[model samples]
Every structure is written in C-alpha cells, then in structure tokens.
Target chain A: MNIPTLSELTARGETPEILFWVGCAGSYDDRYKRVTRAFAKILIAAEIKFAVLGPEESCTGDPARRAGNEFLFQMQAMNNIQILNGYGVKKIVTACPHCFNTLKNEYPELGGHYEVIHHSEFLQQLINEGRIKLTDTTAYKGKKITYHDSCYLGRANGVYEAPRAVIEALDADLAEMKRSKTRGLCCGAGGAQMFKDAEKGNKEINIERTEEALNTGAQTIAVACPFCMTMMTDGVKAKEKEQQIKVKDLAELIAEAQGLA
Target chain B: MIQQILFLLTLLGFAIILRKRIVQISRTIRLGRDVKIDGPTSRRFRNMLLVAFGQKKMFSRFIPAFFHFLIYIGFLVINIEALEFIIDGLAGTHRIFAPYLGGFYTVLMNVFEFLAVAVLVACVVFLIRRNVLKLPRFWSAEMTAWPRLDANIILITEIVLMLAILKMNAADQILQHREPQHYPSTGKLMFSSILIPVLEGYSTSFLIFVERFAWWFHIIGILAFAVYITYSKHLHIFMAFPNTWFARLQPAGYISNMPVVTREVKSMLGLPIEEPGTNEPPGRFGAKDVNDLPWTSLMAAYACTECGRCTSECPANITGKKLSPRKIMMDTRDRLEEVGRNLQNGGNGLDDGKSLLDHYITREEINACTSCNACVEACPVLINPLEIILELRRYVVMEESGAPASWNAMFQNLETNFAPWKFSAADRFNWAKD
Candidate 1:
C-alpha cells in the first residue's frame, strides 16, 4: 500500500482531496492498527486520493483537554493547527471520534478550521456513492452483529446512522443492545479514562457495557471508535469470549466483505 | 409598649446577624477568579426560569419531585404571610392585611394553611428518606455526620416552623371567639382548623398566651433559619436562581477554551498574540485552591444540595471509584467556609497552610473522572462539579506535575511525537502500508 504524506504531496506540487488523521491509537495500538489498515484499504478501493499527516500528525491533545491540562492541550493543538494551516488542509478524516470531535468542533475556535470526518462517516459516504460494494455472501453476512456507540461519536457529536449504515452495507444481521443510542453506556475508556486505572469501582464500565452487548447475543460486536475498540476488546477478553464473540470495527467488517484486508 | 421595644430589638438583632453572614459569603465568593458571566442574557434567563423556578429537571423522578414541588411552592407562596407578619410586628398591629384583603385574605390564608401542612408532610418524608430509608445516593463516603445532620436540621426547622404557624392560628381562633382585647378575627386557617377543636377546652388566658408564644416562635424561627441557611446546603433555595442563570449555555459536551492558554498558544504558533498590560494578576492555568475557581463555580459549591445525583450517575462511582462529584462540591464549600473562618480569626489569607486541592479534594478523586458531563447533566440546580474536577486535574498536571507515571509517559509522547505513543511520528501511516 503506497500512502502519500501531505508534505510529500505538497512538495510534489499536488494536493489530495482529504487528509487522513491516523490518530495515536490507529498509529500505534496493535488492535486498532488493524482498523487503520482496514479503513485505508476501503479508502483505496473507493479511489479517494487521501494523504496521511504522517510525522506532521500528533495527538489531538484530546486527553490533555479532558484531563484539564489546558496549557499542554493548547500547545499540541497549536502545533498541529499550524502545520495544517501551512498545508492549506481543508478536510480531515480520522478513525478516532476523540480526534474527529476535537478537530471538527474544538479546533475551529482555536484557529484550526477544517472539515473533519470520522472514518465511519467516510465509509458510509463511499457505500452511498457506490464507490465501494459488499458481496451478498460475505463472511459476516447474516451474522449477528451489535454496534457499540462511542460516547464522543454518539452523544458528543450525534453520528449514529453513518456507522450503522456502513455496518448494514456488510449484509450482516444488526442487533442493537438495549442502551444503543443516546442512552448508550460508556465503554470504560473515554474522557482520558483510557490513560488511567479504573478508580476503585465495583464493576468496570467496559465490563458493564460488554455485558449489554453480549446480552444481545451478537456473535460480532461492531465499534467505530478506536478507544471503544480497545475497551470493548478488553471486555471481551475479560468475559473469555474471544472465540465465542469477536469484537471488530465497522471498517474491518467492510474490508472483509470487500476482500480488501 | 414593652412588647414593641422587644420586637424592634429582635429585628435589629436579626439585621446584624444577616448582614454579617452576607458579608462573609460575598467575600468568600469574591475570592474566586473573575469570569465573564455576562452573555446571552435571554438564554440565561430561560435556564434560570426552567431549572430554578420551574424545577424542570427534578421532575425526571416523579414521586420525590411532586413532594419537593409542594414544599417549594409553599416556601414561595407562604412568604406572603411573612410580609404581613413583619408589618404587624413593626407597627404593633394585629393582622394588618386582614382588613385590606377582606375575603381574598381568607382565601389566601386558606391556601397558605393548606401548603403549610403540605410542607410539613414533605419535610417529614424527606427526613425519612434521608435518615430512615437511607437512599443509596445520600449515604456516600463524604456524606458524614455534618451533611446528614444539616439535611435533618433543615427539615426539622421547616417542620417546627410549619407547626408553629398552625398552632398560632389555632390559638388565635380561640382568642378571637373569646373576644380578647387585641386578638382580631382574621380568618379560619384551613389545615390548622383541626387544632382549634383540640385547644377549645383550654382556658382563655392560656389560649391567648399560646397564640402569642406560637406567633413569636414562628417569626423568630424564620429569621434564624434564614441566617443559618447561608451556612447550609439549603442555600440552594436562594442561590439556585443565580447559579442556573450563569449556567453554561453551550452544548453540554463542549468545554470552553481558556483565554490565557489561547494567547500563549497563539504566541507559540506565530499568530497575533494580544498585547497585555494590565493591573490584573498573571493568569493561573488551573485551580490550586478554592480561590482559583470562577465565582460561578464557587456559587455552585454553595448551591450544592449534596443530593449525590452526580455521583450516582458517574461511571466511576458506579464502578466503586473514589471520585464522587457531590463530595467535590461539599469539600469546596467546606474549604471556602474554613478560609472565611480563618480570615475572621485574624489569619493571613496566604498562610492558611491548607487548600481545597490536597486538603479537601484528593488526587485520586479528580483523576478518576471520565469528564463524561453526566454529573453536570444530572445536577438539578446546574452545579457543574466537573469544572471543579477539571480545574483540580489541571493543577495536578500543570503545577504539581503529579499525574501518574503512565500519564507522564503519554504527555512526553505528545510533546515529542505529537501522539500518545513511543513510535516515531513518521510511522503513523504504516498501517496504510500493509
């Protein structure tokens, strides 16, 4: 896979249509790295000339802001915004809702104005435009799959349908947990909770959320955000249901249906 | 004549106590950082009306909300009777509004009497809920003897005040029938009418004395309760309006950017930074103590009813986390009061040798928050305990550099690699490379 950086494209006197914000989790987390690969394969199949930030990208300082380190958050945001503004980057697509939310909503006020899109929305757009198609006899077809709503993506930004639309594109059976939409429970890893230990609680939030997903009897738990991907995966492991139930990102399911990954 | 003298003296005493307490509260609130609360007036007023006056959020739970509404309406409507009581006390008159209001007076008194009994019942039910039933939310780690006792005292005070009003009406009814010298035929108090039949067998002089004693006790109790409420969570009765008025009108999930940090970022990014030359102190990044919080945040602390709705909904608290949003507000109020007392005792403000950060709210509690804004949403009076939690976390990160090791590693990665990973930033797109 030949992925061009924004800097390289600019140096070549060319510009891509969109900048792929490969967030830290997608860049480094082993599990989420698969999500990144799956999403990139889908993007390539869609024939969208998207460029990655590569070394120019940094953590969106989402954790800093949530953790109340404003100085640090501003420092990081300023650095990334300056780089984006330098490239005249007009649009951004990220796999992490934390980055999608911060870049789309919070950054404009901080002088970083760009059209930000989460990969789930991007995948749905691809499917809607007929750029990517899924086969009827795909591996996940008719499989019981439940989508877990990430707090930042669902309640924070109200991006519920796009992810589910992408999931439906897989021709899979979509079963929803009781707490699916606005009332969806957190997967024990948001608002900088991913960085710290669970603060001496009776039951971890991810475990509670996982139990909800499992109760739906879905063989596959579909997620859109990398943070939720990490947390829900950990939850599945805790339940020791790795073999029984598989936690997969929507992008991964799509890629499998398309024979891309 | 002597009675008039005693009434005036009592009025003066109440004025003194009320003034002293008001000064202390205002001073403590003023200690917080200055913030621009003046904006979007229409929206603010709408929130104040809905949350404070309408008690809109409280209705999410029906049973308790209905009972609470009774007391709330009673407290507001019955204050009309206090106005007449004040006028009668000042002029040494008996039922001053009785003649002017006529039949309307009877109807008004009847409503007030009915609400008085309703308030008494509601207060009794609340007391039972807190002490006897022991609702899980009210029995958290931070809700020790003082908060529990504070709630009980407020309820007990309301109950006694309601009973005094009823007893006074019952005794006054007897005195009026007996054609006493000063006792006037105001009207029948509806709910308190039951007490008249019971008191009918008593002597006329004893009835007059009972009426006078109950009257004095009710007014005095109200005055004392007013002053004492400033020191209690019951201050929400008054502060809720302003707290809700100054509430955050933005999307619940959006936290505002700090101006001080914005300028510094602008400077770093080669953007046009604002030129600053003012007598204002240097901007502190986050709160180190209670004074570092915004005035509205301090008001929120005072307005907290210690209901623990925030904690109960908190993902961390449900999982048995040490962090309780209710505890954060309670600790803030407690620390603010401590500072006020210290200042009152002739101690320097700088050397209280303690602060809300380490002394009251711990590192464990602030770090545990997921910043989900659930606590903020659950708050009936619009108290954003998350703001306090965030401010304290800021202090830990920026000032003390006291975050856990994993956090420090993440911070370093963010600084060096622009991500929360140890890999080179150039490797970010490796996922796209198969």
Candidate 2:
C-alpha cells in the first residue's frame, strides 16, 4: 500500500481531504504503530483522500502544556501552527485523543484552526456513510467486547457515543465496564503520566481499571486512544490474562472485521 | 418595649458581624489574579439553576442526596419562620402573621414543622454517617481533627436548633391555652404538637418562660450559624451559585494557555504580536500561592463544601496516592485564610515565608495527578481541582525547573526530537511502511 505525505501531496499540486495526525505514540510506539497502519488501511479501503504530515508533524505540545512547561508548550504549538497554517490544512483526524483534543480545542487560540475529529468518530462516520463495509461472520461476531473510555476522549471532550456506535457496528455484544463514560476510570497515562512512573500508590491505576474491564467478562477490550491502548495492554499483561483476552483499538477491530488487516 | 429594644440591638450587632465576615472573605478572594470570565449569561444562569438551586449533581448519590435535599429545603423554607421571629421580636407581638393569614398561617406553620422534623432526622443520619458508620470519605487523611469536628458540630447544631424550634412551638401551644392574651392560638402545628405531651402540666408562667427561652435560643443559634458559615466549608451554601455560574465552559481537557508565554513565543517566532509592549512587570509563570491563581479558582476554594466527593472520585486518591483533591481546595482556602489574617493584622501579605506550595500542599501530591478530570466531574459545585494542580505544576516546571528527572528527559526529547521519546521525527512515517 502506498501512503502519501503532506509534502509529497503539496509537491504533486494536490490536496488530500483530511490530514492524518500520527501522534508521538502512534508514530514511535511499536504496538501503537500497528493501530496507525490499521487505521490507514481503513481510510484507503474507504477511498478517503488522507495524507500524513509525517516528519513535518511535531508533537502537539499536549504533554508539555499538561506538565506545566508553558514556554516549551507554546514554542512547540507556535511551530506546529505555522506549518499547519502554511499548508492551509482545514481538517484533521487522529487516533490519539490527546492530539485530537489539543488540535480541536487548544489550537484555535494559538491561531491553528481546523476541524479535528478523533479516529473513532471518523470511523463511525465512514460506517454511517457506508464507505466501509464489514464481512459477515468476522472474528468478533457474537463476542463480548468492552470499550475503555479514554479520559481525554470521554469526560474531557464528551465524545462518548461515536466510539460506542463504531463498536456496535461490528455485530458484537458491547459489554460496558462498571465505570464507563462520565465516571470512567483513567488508564493512568494522562497529564504526561505516560512519560514518568506513577507516584507511590497501593496499586497501579491501569491495573484497577483493567480489573473493572475484566469483571465484565468481555473477551476483548477495545480502545480508541493510543495511550489507553498501551496502558490497557500493559494492564491485561499484568493480570496474566493476555492469552485469554486481547486489547485492540476500534480501528484495528473494524479493519480486521473488514478483512483489510 | 424593653424586649423590643433588646431584640433590635441583638439583631443589629449580629448583622454587623456577618457583614464584616462577608467583606473579609470577598477581599481575600479579590487577592487572586483577575481573569475575565466572559461567557453566555443565559448559559451561566442555567448552570447556576441546575447545579446550585436545582441540586442536580447531588442526586448522583441517591441516599445522601435525599437527606441533603431534605436539609436544604428545610433551611430555605424554615427561614420563613425565622423572618416571622424577627418581626415578632421587633413589634413585641405574638404570631403577627397569624391574625392576617389565619388558616394559611396554620398551613405554613405545619409545613415548617414538617420540615423541622425532616431536618432533625437528616442531621441525625448525617451525624451517624460521619461518626458511627464512619464513611471512608469523611475520614480521609485531610479530614484531620478539626474538619471532622467542624462537620459534626454543624450537624449537631442543626439537630439542636430543630429541637429548640419544636420545644418553642409546643410551649407556645400550651401558653395559648392558659394565657390567650399573650400567646393567641395559631392553630395546632403538626410535628410540634407531638411535643405537647412533653410540655403539658406546666404552670402558665413556667410555660411562658419555656416559650421565651426556646425562642431566644433558636434565634441566637441561627444567627451564630450564619456567621459560622462564612468561616466554615458551609460557605458553599451561598458560594455554589456564583461558582457554578462562572465555571469553565471549555472542555475539561483544555488547559488554558498562558498568554504571557504566548506573547514571548510570538515575538521569538517573528509572528505579529497581538498586544505588544505592556508597562507591567512579567508575573510568575504559574501559581506558587493563592494570590497567583485566578479569582474564580480562589472563590472555588472558598466555595468547596469539603464533602470529599472530589477526593472520593479522584483516581490518585482512590489508589492511595498522596493527592487528595479535597486537600488541595482545603489547603488553598487555609492558605488564603492565613494571608487574610496577615493582612488584617497589618502584616505583609503572602510574604511571611509561607505559601500554598510546600507549606500546605506538597510537590508529591501535585505530581500524582493524572489530570483525568474525575474530580472535576465529581464536584457538585463545578470545582476544578485539576486546574489548581496544573497551575502549581507550571510553577514547579517553569519557575522552579523542579520536574522529576524522567520528566525533564521527556521535555528534553520533546524539545530536540519533537516527541516525548528519543526518536527521530524522520521515523514518524516508518509506521506506514509495513
């Protein structure tokens, strides 16, 4: 499969429909890289004209700002805004809730305005438009799948329904964890918590959240955010249930169900 | 006439004290940095109605919400009777409204009596929940001695006040029978009439004394409670309205940008600055003390009811981490009180070598937050403890450069490589290479 970068598209004198923001985690984390590919595959299958910023896409400075380094955060934000505004980017979609949140909500103030949509919402839109069709009798058919709400996506942005709708489109039983949606527990990796070890606590936050997910007796834990993907995968491993249950992103699940993976 | 004069003096004295206390609180809140909180007025008014007056968020916990609603309605409705007390005290008349309203007055007294009983029951249950059941929320580390005592004192005081009103009503009913000239019949009240059996067989003079004593005690207790609210967490009763009205309307994840840093960065990048060249000195990067936070945040600190709802919902606190969101608000309020006291004593404010940072809250507590917004979502009054955490973190990282070593490395990687990890930006598209 051939994927075009924004620079390549610009040189070819063509503009794609949406700029796919492959966040720091999506680009660098080995496990999350697969999610990036799976989501890209879905976009290709749907014939959506999407291009990536690739090397030109810097961090959205979500971590910097969250960690209280405003000077560094603004420096990075201003740099990204210059590149994005120069490209005349009008729309952005990302698999990372942090990037989606910063670009959609925080960027307009810094003058990088764009309609930012999380990948889950984008996927739901694709399915709703019948752009991507799933094959019958897929791996998740009649199976119980639980979706973990990323704090940035759930309570932070109030985008709770789009991801759930995407999950339901798979013809699978969507079992909800005890704490989901507004009261959903964090995966223990926000506010730059992903970069540093957790402070002294009785138990890890991801483990607690995983316990809630496991209590639902679901066979798969579906996530939308790459950060939650890493944390929940670690949690499933910690509980020694990696073999019995699998942690998959919503895009990966839809891609596999569509026979595109 | 002498009784009327004495009542007027007491009322005037307490009103002055209450006004002074409120003024002091407002002044302390004003010490915080001013930030414009412009938003749709209708939306803010709607938020106040739903969250504060409507008690919408409280209903999340049914049992407690039910009891709290009882007390809240009781406080509002019973105050009507307190208004009558003031009037009767001023005119030296008995049941002044009773002559005009007649049957409706009995209905109003019966409703007030019913609410008094409800308040009495709710307060007892809350006292038991705190002391006997020992709900974990009320016993968190920050609850300490005084907080626990403060909660108990208020609950017990409410119970005592309710009983005093009932006793006064019963004595009045008995005096109406014996000395109709002084205590004219206002019809039998429902819940208070239940106490008639307890007050029966008492002499007319004795009954009048009981009536007068209970009346004085109940009114004085209410006056004291009003003054006490300004100093206690119960300030939420009044502050919740304004706090909810001025709550942050943006998504919970949106940490407000530091415009000062924005201007500096714009100049460095050669981007046209929005407002160039101000005469004011550059302020500290973030909050080191209460005065550094926005006035809304400081007001939120004063408005916190110390219910531990935020703490109970906090992931860090739930996991046994040092960061209790309740403690953050409590400490902010405590530090603000200290500064207020310092200013009142004619000493330098915020210069006593004490601050909200290490003095009350610690670096460890602030670092533990995941910025999950659980506490913000859990807050019944729209308090954002995460905002406070973020402000303090800005102070630590930018002003003090005291982030943990790992975070510093992450910041370094973000600076050079444009990511948190030490990977080349060139490798960003390698994920698409299969």
lDDT of 1 by residue, A173-227 (tens): 8899986665577787887889877777689889988999999999999999888
Candidate 1 per-residue lDDT, tens place, B1-434, comes to: 67778888998999999999999998999999888765689999999999999999888678889999999999999898999888888888988887788788888889999999999999999988988899998888988998889999999999999999999998887887788567656677677789988999999888878988998999899999999999899999999998999997755556667877787677766778765436576656688898889988998999999888788877788788888999999999999989899888888763678989888888888888877666776788999988888888887887778887778887887788877767888777677665
- Which candidate leads in DockQ? 2
Interface RMSD of 2: 0.8
TM-score of 1: 0.89
Candidate 1's TM-score on the B chain: 0.96
Report the number of the highest-TM-score candidate: 2
Q: What overall lDDT, based on C-alpha atoms, would model 1 receive against the true structure?
A: 0.85
- Each model's lDDT comes to 0.85, 0.92
Runs of candidate 1 with Cα error greater than 4 angstroms are A1-19, A37-51, A115-149, A154-184, A200-202, A215-222, A250-261, B180-189, B255-271, B277-284
Error of 1 at B134 (Å): 1.0
Clashing pairs in 2: none
